[model samples]
Target: MISTWRRRVAARRAAKKKSIEEDDNANMELTIPNHFRCPISLDLMKDPVTLSTGITYDRESIEKWIEAGNVTCPITKKILRSIEPIPNHAIRQIIQDWCVENRSYGVERIPTPRVPISSHEVKEVLTKIEDAIRRNDDESCLDFVSMIKSLSKESDRNKRCVVSNGAGRVLSAAFDALSKRDPIHEHVALHEEILSMLMISLSSPLDEETRTNLSTSESLHYIVRFLRFGSLSSRRNAVLALKVILSCNDQEVVEDLVKREGLLDALMKLIEEPICPTTTKASLLAMYYILKSSQSNPDKQATISKFLEMGLVQNLLEILVDSERSVCEKALGVLDGICSHREGRNKVSENVLTVPLMVKKMLRVSDLATELSVSILWKLGKDEENGEGTVAIEALQVGAFQKLLLLLQVGCSGTTKEKVTDLLKILNVHRQSVECIDSLDFKNLKRPF
Candidate 1:
C-alpha cells in the first residue's frame, strides 16, 4: 500500500510538469480572430477567462475585460467584446427597420418624451404674485421669488423659459394694471421694498422686448439706484443687471449714467474700500464703462487719480500679491491698462501712478505668488519714461535688480524664462542691469543674459 501511494504522488508530479510544458507551447501558438468577441459584454476579450456553465463573472469585471479586447475564453477561442450598442454589420438593417416603422407621408408623429405643465398651474402662480403686488406685500413677493427659484432648481432650461416668458409678461401687465388702478402708488420713487423685487426680476434673463419695456417704466429708477448702492445681498444682482443694460451699448444710456448724480462718486468710493474685493473689482469694471462714455477731461482724470492717490496702487497690488491665479491675472490686466492708457500713462509719468513704489511692493512680495507676476513685471518694464523701459532701468534702486532676478526664478516655465533672459539682456545692454545677473547661478541657462 505504501509503494502504491508513492507511485501515485510521482504520477501526479509528472502530470503537472507535462501540463506546464503544454501551457508554454500554447502561449506561443494562440492567435485571436478579428471578428470574435466576448458573449457577456459583447466586446473583444482581453486575458479572457473561460467559464464553466456554473461559473459566472460579475458585470463590472466583464466590462473591464471588454475594454481590453485581447481576453479570450480558455475553452473556445472567441472575441466577443464591443462598445457599439449594436454590431456594425447589422446597424444598417436596424436603422432601415426603424425608419420604415416611423415612415408615413405627411404624418405628424408624437415626440418620444413629453413634459407636462397645466395652464392653470402657471396662472395660479401669476395671480398670487399679482395679488401680492396689488397689496404692496413684501412677504408675498419673497414667496413668489422663492417659488420661481425652487422650480429653477428642478429643470433649469424649462423653468428659465417658463419664468422668463410667463413671469416677465405677467409682471409687465401687472405694472400696467397697477398704474391704471392707482397712479399715485404706481410709478413710485425708489424704495427698498420695490427695489428688491425689481432686482430679482431683472436678474432673470429677460427677453429683449421685456427688457426694453421694463427699462421704459419709471420704476427702473429703483433698479438704477440699487445698482449705485444697495445692501450686499442686492448689490450683485443690481450690478449684473446694469452690465446687461450696458451691453446693449446704448450711447444714450451711457450718457445718462455718466450724468447721474452719484454713479461716479459711489464707484470711486467703493474702489477705496479695503473689504469686498469682488465688489471693488466689479466697481472697477463699472468705472471703465463710465470712463469710456464720459469725456476724457480733467474732471474724469482727477476722479480716477484721486483713487490712485488714495493709494489704490497699494491696495490693488496687495490683491495681486495673494489672489487666486485667475483673479491675480485679471487684476494685473486692469493695472496694466490703468497705467498704460493715454490718460493713465500720463498719470504714471507724473508719479501719481508711482512706478518705483509699485516695483518696491512687487519686490516685497515673493516670486512664488503666481506665474502672472512675471507678466506684471514685464508690463511695468514697458513704461520707458525717462529711460524706464517698463520700470526706470536707469534709476532702478540698489536692491531692485536682485528682486527681479529672484522673481524670474519662481513659477516661470521655459518660454517665460527665455523672455526673462531677454529682458535681462536688454537691461544690461543699457548698462543699468549689469550687476544684477553677476550675483546669480546660471550654469544651466541656455541663453546668455
Candidate 2:
C-alpha cells in the first residue's frame, strides 16, 4: 500500500512540476534610465514632445492625458493655454546617441518619430491614386503605391485616414490588375508594394463600401491566388484581407470561393504549418467565417465536406491543443461551426480527444475561449445519438461534467449560462450509466432556462 501511495504521490508531484514549467517563462528585467522615461508611463519615451506648460512627455501619453479632459499639466498642475505638442528633438537625439553608444549592452535605438498625416493630404493622395488606377497607368500606380505605403508608415492616424478615405479599394484594384498580368511584364517589386498597401489598409477598421469592393469576385480570385503562389508578404496580407472580407457579409463571393478548387486546402495547410502567428490567426478566422456561412446555404454541404476532406478537424484540434488563447478561441469557433452539421457532429462525437481537449480548454484559457468551447460541447451534446447514450454522456464520462459545473459555479456570460444549463440536462439524462457523475451534484446545477 505504501509503495502504491508513494508512486501516486511521485507521479502527481512530477505532473504538477511539469505544468508549472510549461506555464512559467524565463524572467526578463529591463531598465530605462530615469531621464529617458516618460513621466506618464515611467517607460522610455519614443516620441517626446513639449507641452505648453513647459514639460516634456511622450506624445501618445500626453495626448491621451489631455484628451481625458485634464486641464492642467500632470507635472506642474498648471493650466495650459494650448495643447499642441511641440516635438522635443533635443531629447530624442540624446536618447538615440546614448542608445548607439550602449549598443553592445543590449540597448536598441528608438525609431524615427512619426508625424500624423492630415485628412486633407490623404484626400489629395487618394484622388491621384484613383485616377492612376482608373487609367491603368502602371508607372503611376507604382509611384502612388510607394507614396501611400510611406504615409501609412508615418502613423496609425494616417493609416486610418488611408482606409476611411477608400485606400483599401484603390490598393486592391491595383493589386488585381497587376496580379492578372504576365509575370515577365510586371515590375515584381511594384506588384508587391500594392499587395502590401492593401494589407495595411485592411489592417485598420474598414467601412462597408471598402469591404464590398474587395469582396468582388475578381478581387477575391487574386487574393486567393496570392495564398497559393505569392510571396510570404503576399500570403500573410492575403490571409488578413480574406479574413476581413469574409466578415463583410458577401455570401455570393464566399460561395464562389467555396466552389473554387484548392482554396480551402491552401488555407488549412497554412494553419497546419503557419508562416507566423498572425498568418495562422487570420487563416483560422477565414475558415471560421466560411464554415459559418455554409450553415444557412443548405446547398453548401460540399463546403463543409471539403473542409473535412482537407483534414480541417484534425488541424483545428491540433491548434486547440498547443496554441495560445487567441488561436484556441478561433479553432473552437471553427469547431463550433463544424458541429452545426450532421457529418461534423459525427466527426466531433467519434473523436476521443475532441471532448477532453475542449473540456480542458473551457476554464483553462480566457473567458472567451471558455464560451466558445462550452458552446462546441453544447452543440455536440444536444445532438441525438444512440450508443453509450448521448454525446453529453460521453462528455460527462470524459470529466466535462466537472468543468461545466465549475463554469456555472463561477460566473460566465448569460449565453454560456443557457448553454451550460441545457448541457446539464443532456448529461443528467444519462448520468445513471456514466460512473463518474453524481446524481445529487447533477440536480444542484442551476438550470434557470
Candidate 3:
C-alpha cells in the first residue's frame, strides 16, 4: 500500500510539471519572431512579398502603398525600379510551419493568399465586355459583368483596378445599349447584373471623364427606371448610385435630373417605404441636393411647388415625428428648403403636426435638427400671408413659446440666435392668446380667458 501511494504521488508531480512546461511554452510563444512580422504593419506577414529594394512586406500592405502613388520602398526609402513585388514564398512557408508548430498555443495558420488581379487583366475583361455589348450578346455581357462584379468584391485594390481600367465607361455604355435595344422585361437578369457592376464602379474614385460618362441624361434615365421598377437590391443600389452621381455633377445636370418624369415620385416612394435606412437617407439627400441646386434657377419656386404638390410636406413631417438624428436632420433640411417659397411655407403651416413636431424636436434631437426646425418655423412665422400671427398662434399653441425661451437661455450661434429672437417676437405677439393648460383647472377654467 505504501509503495502504491508513493507511485501515485510521483505521477501527480509529473503531470503537474508537464502542465507548467506547457504554460511556459505558451507564454514564450506569445512573442512572435521579429522577422515574421511585416515591416510596415508590424503584424505577422501572411503573404510576404519582396520589393525591388529587397525589403519584404505583406502583399496587401505593400500593394496599398504602391497604389497610393508611392514609388519608393516603405522601409528603405529607395526608389523602386519596378513596383511589382515578387512573392516571398520561402518566408510564407516558414511562417506556416511556425504556426503549425505552435498549434497547441492557439496560433492560427494563415492560408495562401490569392494573386491580385492586375490592371491588364481588368482591361482585358473590359475589352470582352465591350465586345459583347457591341455584339448585342446578352449572355456574354451577363457572364463578363458577373466576373467583373466578383473581382470588384474581392478587394479594394481590385475595385480600384476595375474602375481605373475604364470600367465605368464600359458599364455606362452597356447600360445605354441595354436601354436602346432591350425592353425592361426582356433581360431582367442582364439589366440587374449591369446595374450591379455600375454600382461597384461608382463606388471607386471617379475621374472627370468617368463622371461625365456616368452623369449623362440617358444614363440618368435608365437609373431612374431601375430605381422605380428594379428588384429590392437593385433599387437600393440604384438610389445610392444616384446620390453619388448627382453629387459629382453640376447644378445644371441636377436641374435636368429633377425634371425627369417620375423622378420625384420614385424618391418619395423610397422615403415613404424605405428598403433600408441607408436608402432612405440617400433619397432624402438626393432631394436636398436637388432643392439646393435649383436655388439659382429661374424656376426655383416652381421647383418647390413641384415638391409640395408631391406631398413632400407630409412625408417630411412624418419623418421628423420618428427617425434617427441623421435622418431627422436631413428631413428637416429639405423641409426648410421647401419653406423658402411661399407655397412651401403655406403647405408646412397647413399641417397641424408640423409646428408641434418642430417644437418637440428643438431641444431633443440634435443641434443641427434644432437649427433646421427653427429655420422652418421662422420662415412660416415671417410669411406675409401668415404675418397675421396665425403661424405664431399655431406655434404658441404647440409650446414653441417655451422652447424658444429655452433656446435663448442655453445660448446659440449668431445666426440661430437671430432666428430665435425673431421667432420669440413673433410667438410673443400671440402669447396672450395662448391658454396655459398647466395653470388652468379644467373644472374651474372658463373658455376664452
Best candidate per TM-score, number? 3
Mind giving the per-residue lDDT tens digits that candidate 1 earns over 109-178?
2222223233455567777877786787647755764565455445543354445446666565444334
| Model 3 pairs in collision | none
Question: All candidates' lDDT scores?
Answer: 0.49, 0.78, 0.82
Q: Please give the range of 10 consecutive residues that has the lowest summed lDDT in model 2.
A: 437-446
Taking the candidates one at a time, how many backbone clashes does each contain? 28, 0, 0
Where is model 3 poorest over a 10-residue stretch in terms of lDDT?
437-446
Could you estimate the TM-score for every candidate? 0.48, 0.72, 0.83
**Candidate 3 ranges with C-alpha deviation above 4 Å:** 1-13, 26-29, 63-69, 182-187, 203-208, 215-217, 248-260, 297-306, 384-386, 393-417, 428-449
Q: Using lDDT as the measure, which candidate wins?
A: 3
Off by over 4 Å in 2: 1-58, 65-124, 154-166, 176-189, 203-205, 385-387, 437-449
Q: Compose the digit string of candidate 2's lDDT tens values, residues 1-449.
A: 99999999999999999877755532334457898999999988898998888899998898788768888899999998886678899999999998897675577999977667665677788778778866767688778778888988877756766776777767766666655566534556666677778777775446755665676666677777778878888888878888888876578878878777678888987987789999998998898889888899788898888888878888788888788888888888989999999898888777777877877777677889889888888877666633455566667776777778788888899999999998887787777776463344334445445
Q: Which candidate, 2 or 3, has the higher TM-score?
A: 3
Alpha-carbon lDDT of model 3: 0.82
